[model samples]
Target: MASLSQLIAKPATFSVSTPRTSSGQYRPRRATVQCASSRGGERSEPDAPKHQDRRDPRRARRQCHRHPDVRASRRRRPRRDARRLLLRRRGPSAERQRATCCPPPSSAPAVDFTPPDAASLPLRTRPAAHSVTADYVAKFNAGIAAMKALPPDDPRSFSAQASVHCAYCDGSYSPEGFPGVELQVHNSWLFFPFHRCYLYFFERILGSLVGDPSFAMPFWNWDAPDGMRLPAMYADQSSQLYDPRRDGRHGTPKLIDLDYSGTEPRFTDKQQVDHNLRVMYRQMVSLSPTPSLFFGSAYRAGDDPNQGPGPLENVPHGPVHVWCGDPKQPAREDMGNFYSAGNDPLFYAHHANIDRMWSVWKGIDARRHTDLTDPDWLDASFLFYDETPQLVRIRVRDVLDTGSLRYQYQDVPLPWTAARPTVTRRADSLLAPAAQAAAAAARKAGDFPITLDEATSVTVKRPVAGKRSKAEKASEEEVLVIDGIEVDRDVAAKFDVFVNAEDHGAVGSGGRELAGSFVNVPHRHGHGRGRGRGHGKNGGGIKTKLRLALNEQLEDLKAEDDESVVVTLVPRQGKGKVKIGGVKIELMH
Candidate 1:
């Protein structure tokens, strides 16, 4: 019945030992800190607990009774009938719901098309920013100019193309059956599919305008060290590719921080590159080994569109947006704000990289080559105007394979796959006897398992005076290890973790109190085999630990003598649940 903080207050005795590796180096085996807990707070010391099988009929029935969305899905009937029922349930909001229940008057021509044969269509290769040739640059500039020259009303025109992003993302439209609910597509499962289709049509429009069916959109390859700078082609003031409303501070020579929130840190170019590569490895290779983790949570019919973003979307996708937007401008217009993001010419190029990641993710292994099988996910539809100025209804099922869409990206080296952070200092040397004792005591503290359903903060009070050493005081760095993060295998939930954040909403707005994020990689049923070799036999839900290097975050909190440190978890979107079994802090030497 003791709280984690209370347990930490009463120190527990422990010892540390140094082990040697085959390389004749002293490898410190970190003491095993067992802090596992079951649903009823029963303690367990197993190495790793097996996640609950989602395919179990009993578990499904239990979840169905507990979750409102699951219950609604079970009772779902025909679309028309469901709309009527949803509207009636709106009560006083019924009048507003009627507009969405009825179809809008269509003025745009309908699109009729056949899926193009992959072999027959020309493959438009999007080259990386660093590898783009002078000839390719010329073509890209020409294509942009031609698109810009088109009339404002033309769907292929630059203005019209930008408006498409504004309309859908900025709440210009609502779901057909849910009138009062705004259709916000940024933070949900729709993030990937919707943007994929948008870029597909936009690329086609550019090709048509340039009179070259093979003209491909260039991608801003920010993942690699060489491609970290904003592509030089877009910075040319005289070129059509140039956008005047970008962050002046983020011009050429400034490296892109994949984990950028808002503030700039003092990291050497090499350090920044190494950090970026490590982040890429974590997001693409380690964290995301399944479709649900890669693509994000599902947003089906009659559901809200904020059900969490995948790792790719949450990280580089969002940070890149904030990094590019002019900080001086109100709301960071152009690339920063959702409604005006596409207005910037570089937006398409930036998204081209995001789209390229999807292709690269699929090619990583055979098990990851599949898409979501849920009928609601597969059949989810969005409206967009294609090259012909004809409104087309694109389904999630239509764009699963990029090859079928008649485009591809230039193959590039994935340096992050082999990137592993090396420990320069010996653990014993870094942790003095006193520090070691403190760490062991902290580990013995009872685990605190908190379920995140909404914005919540937990405060842990621990005296800091006696815990500090000369090295710790000089470095002011520590490691925060969170163990046993478990989420439902079927739900793609993600939450941003923050320490000492006064306002949860402002956590990632360039605040110094921001900690890392916890992204869930959900289980895929009937996949025969799992995507990554790490999954092994146990593959039901996201159950893993996070070791965050919190030197900077802790320094920002100035909690050296503070009695309590508040940790906050903010869900990216919609409703999803996650449970954390324990938290530990160790000195990082």
Candidate 2:
């Protein structure tokens, strides 16, 4: 019988050919082949060269397409939209293309979880970063030391626990039935669920080793002003929780920038705190009003990870990782890189806060209080070793309710609740009553829609309504409204949207033309029925909308008289392609 690995290695199909030259010498001509599973049956031009040992099972497995049968079916079926096909072939574009008709293999039933009796399993409330007492800190330290002292081979040991992250995220483990594909948890809808489960087991192990079932991991509440800096408890050099490989400049007392992307302009303490609060407001309340936007792109079984990142994951998530990583190290060792992020004890605390935000967002409104209903999302599963050293599989649906996991975050004030955009009173005064009424009416009507699926610059010409007079142009309230932004699948890709920018490369935080940006959070494809604001049309993907108050930006560009304004879509960190279903330039009252 074949070994487990061999059995899991599915056969990949390829066509073979050998054409002889006219001369005595023989020149072989290879048939062009396409991998059916690669980005929705898109053709892979120029087939690879033939190998000598074609009969070798290992070689065949390596060379075979992920879904050869699907490719055959695609050839038999009619072609799809030429524009969408062209967009896919051109690489990452914002166009929404149809997925392959070949449906993914049915997943196993959702993982089962029988919650222990409330009285038997004590609930643990994670303390706030600023409020943890000295005794609580001591216990936390003791738990870390105990975890580190365990035998290296033990699954609960510090090294073993960290390896779980590397294996799942760093491409060390292949999905159980898909050997050629690596299992990745980041950059998709799985970001929240996977990390939540990981933290669940890690916290359990820590608590078990410390002999305190009620012990809860403290969260690094970077969203709040007081919790911006590294928690004081973790900064002690001698403590087991202290990881030496952290950003040297990020020690306590230095205000943490929530929008940190390597370099940030120095701001006064008060200024930085205000900025952090505004960012929180934008991420939690303003931008993410739906499950798809809040949780990110949906990742289904057998798909590649990192399709897109949710808003929270994009901002504080990736930036926090970059900020915590040691600058001197090549791979940013502990906290910066994906493979080694879990090595830093701080990673858990960081994720705990991310988990906390999910709970908090759910309470914000009725529409936000649910998870995606797609079976591919709900049934998605991952394996992890529990405290008993027995490997266990968990599903996304299992952890939807944090209370079921027997842990909750300590209650804290949400300052972003009152946070508001700091528009100057003078700019506010420019809006005439007639213009304001018109803007409100236009918003309700949903006009001026445009679709974008590529990284290109588009100029929106001001609508020529009988040629606007100078006074009319000055009084007109214009807003760059990006609505119904959706993606075809789960991915962690984001693009920086700019206005009237000369060079995309030169634009940065301080760049004058930088208007705003959007992250295409990961969501599952073919599951487009979303609940809440800016929901996508049925048969489309998950959608969200953004309205950039661009009065000041346009004034800076001196573009009031210009016939059109140029908007550039530049991807951040070279993430994959995404699609924008609709955009509109609204000349509000």
Candidate 3:
């Protein structure tokens, strides 16, 4: 890492292409972004491949995944004509070019960004999707219909807005200073703020189009029992809100399973609902008690993207995406994959709830569960064209408050607060008497950075006693760091983390040892863009980290007084493809 002084001294310049029309053709004028570089060291560009595969139209189609009308456009063109059209447009050397989802640059000159004063904005209330009246639904449908009616060239159009998510998520653009390093918002601390800003502008555009400045989008409140099923408004085929690309099996009357991972559970509807409430309790309370545990690991300039996702992002967030997507489509076309998630009308409503979680998190503990104060996190910025079609730059600091943005969620019942998980048995009984006697010593002596060919476990030392006050120990969280994870991006991988649990320790009713899970729903990536610590063929994998807090879990396991606890890594999805670098416990005071 470079020093703060050295990072501040370097000027960072990013090349921005001209705005593009509906046909994905660039305009004449170009825009450039200039800012103080925060990267510590210079990173060389990735090495080019020796061969290029340009003959296949399937390869080319994957590159254009960001366009919302891609599937429709493909259906319109004949098979032979589509191939010829692609070849004619791309030329022979097109294989060498990198696929990108970068949105059109601003037509105007770039300027330093500053957030508007909070007092200047009027308050607006966002309603729950299930509770909205017919009038509100009609207005929202009209707003979406209006956006879709606009030409794709317009920045405020539905197609352009959807592409914004793809550009930021799918390695389309690089940070201002880091040339080859991709700027991704998903697996880092940038996830919450980035999405907040995106939805803010999107809501504003919809409001302007409908001639209702106070128009607020509805949030799919899937967290509660009554709001568990897909919102009724979105399921109506006659409405513009309906999308045919969703999973047909997950339609209305089917309760959403928060812990869904491709495989369906045989639990009854009541059981599923109860399970979802417990899932919410574990994710929002037990698993995530700190900002770092909730928002995820930090990703600085020049760092590889997908560092790791927070507890909530790894579970219900990821699972909900996979559940809604059509299972038949390759890469689960609409809501499942990152590239095309925004194409579905349900995507915005789904994210509106995610954005709502940010507020609910703060209300849980106003003082302790506040926003991050890191300078790198606060200064990170993005470019977006507002409702007026004027390009404006916004930073993380600009969106720290819902009041400042002039929006508040409709108050609802939080039944999950009382659903905290319980441990039925003792941890020592999970292992044999002899194994328990030597567990700590054997764990301490064992080597780390092991490959996950099978279920792996390690013993991690707890915080030293007498080093801190009792009050500090009670307030501060104990975080488990599973650093330097390497895995293939093409593989559907998932693994659950458990504390002090052996194979025999698993509870039959409710998973007592289960802490949380890390899941990666497979998505297609362009050739030659894969670069990381993994040794996959064609350099196709990612290197990241995962963190989980143990403040409440330790107490449940009756391991708070113990000096060490056995940490287990159970591979539920991709077994041999995962590799873990090391594990340790740190007291975050």
Candidate 4:
């Protein structure tokens, strides 16, 4: 395999349609995102075939599978106003899309024929410049040096005090912006790259402060049913860290409060919508809770603070694994307008995982990875920060050439590499007695650990769940393909859409649904309080689950490959405004 230097130095190809930098090279295709307030034009198209399918099969099977009687289920506990993110769940009619996996009478291959594993492929290795550990340290120093160069009132300085400004409002940030774009660099495509960039800087600062350059990022995925507690880095009592139940009054992370064991997920109009900002208002803004005396104004749910219901209360763990994002983080609102690569702190690592998840998705249901050829969805563009920290724009086409990029993550074995999905094995005794008792209750209700693929057959000894409004059961199998990527049919199995703005990791809806919503409410008027109840600052707290789907339909990705199978996925949604940096997920529940 070519070295990392070759990947970074690979020349970017472009046409008038695909934007290129002043250097006139497609180096890292990033665009200077212009908000609704800026001059806008549809992006230039590329010369490659609209759709390209290059999924790695080894990873797909991990998405999920059933042994024989496995069931698909979701419980609609009580609906709290906040959890009403991105509207409601809509899918094809239960006829084909529901959780049942019994195949209809057909002669289709029981499983698609597998091409022999591509003959031995070369391994990807990096030289000193492309090294993850090395770059991490260098970038850390660069950020610190840059931070020191900024004035006291500069935004970077404000970050030191956890005083992020409202990217929209000229004032301090709110996790969500108020009226204008947050930082020029913030936007939808930028979410991952930006945060990864932020984390690079943040990690360096932390490393510099503590004398530990090797401190890896503490991912919060430890909350699975089996690994359901904060990782030891944050939750160890001996560490003497800040407890959520104790010092939890901040609209910020504590000095070292990486623990996210808030017990249950946050629900309620104010709590749910606070950070998961939407794009309905003049601009999206972060509504994360604060140490202040009161939660602010809202038409719904927000009590008079002086009156009933109190100031936006939190119903913790009402449901777990939920979160919204900071509008300042990109990838939240739209993929077409920004660069997502360089913005995220965990960009490389996170995508490594997401890419891994895609492999897992197709592995679970080989057919689910086919792209439904659709048009509008195919021509999307996103932004990213390059290895040089220069914001460059990219398209779905650009991502296909992963080897040409500067970063490639360390190899981590997939969860489903085993014959049968071990899923996640935990010592049953690891739970606190209370949690253990709770697990028993959940088990009785068939809500214990679940491997989500609908193909998997397992017994759910309990009565299955539902609030199925006939229409609620999606039957029409409309397929959506965006750029060249196919949303695995089982996207929903791995993710749960939520309301906060700063919460990243969940899938953002693609365009079709938003277009539908636009067709429904042609005017840009308010639609009540949206999912956030009356307290949401704008749009509604909206974020997609890690499930394999987009928010819309695309009929544009059919290449001349008879070996490829066409699959459908639901894309994430986007209203008319800019919701930048919604991609930066500070914390996810």
Candidate that scores best on lDDT:
3
Task: Give the CA lDDT, 0 to 100, for residue 358 in model 2.
Answer: 87
Give the lDDT of residue 9 in candidate 4: 9
The residue-by-residue lDDT of candidate 3 on 474-501, one tens digit each, is: 6787888888777776566777787776
Clashes of each: 3, 22, 1, 135
TM-score winner between 2 and 4, please give it: 2
In candidate 1, stretches whose alpha carbon ends up further than 4 angstroms from where it belongs are 1-109, 118-120, 176-179, 421-515, 518-589
**Per-residue lDDT for 198-245 in model 4, tens only?**
333333344344344443433322112212232232232333221232
Worst 10 residues of 2 by lDDT: 18-27
Estimated TM-score per prediction? Answer: 0.61, 0.62, 0.80, 0.28
User: Which residue ranges in model 2 land beyond 4 Å of their true spot?
Assistant: 1-112, 175-181, 423-457, 460-495, 498-589
Candidate 3: which pairs clash?
449-581
**Whole-model lDDT values for every prediction:** 0.54, 0.55, 0.66, 0.21
lDDT of 1 by residue, 1-589 (tens): 1111100000000100111000000011111111110111121122322233323446433221110000011113233321111110111122222111111112322343345675645877878877888888888788888877877545567766775565445433222233233344555667887788889888888887777878788889898888999889988899888888888988888998877656685778887888788777656754455576567665543444345566687677777887887767655667876656777989998888998888788878766445777655665555566665555656677888887788878888889777643323232331356533433333132546766667655555443544466555445435555666665433445566666544556333234455667543222121111111112133323345554545434444555555455566677532446776777665432
- Which candidate achieves the best TM-score against the true structure? 3
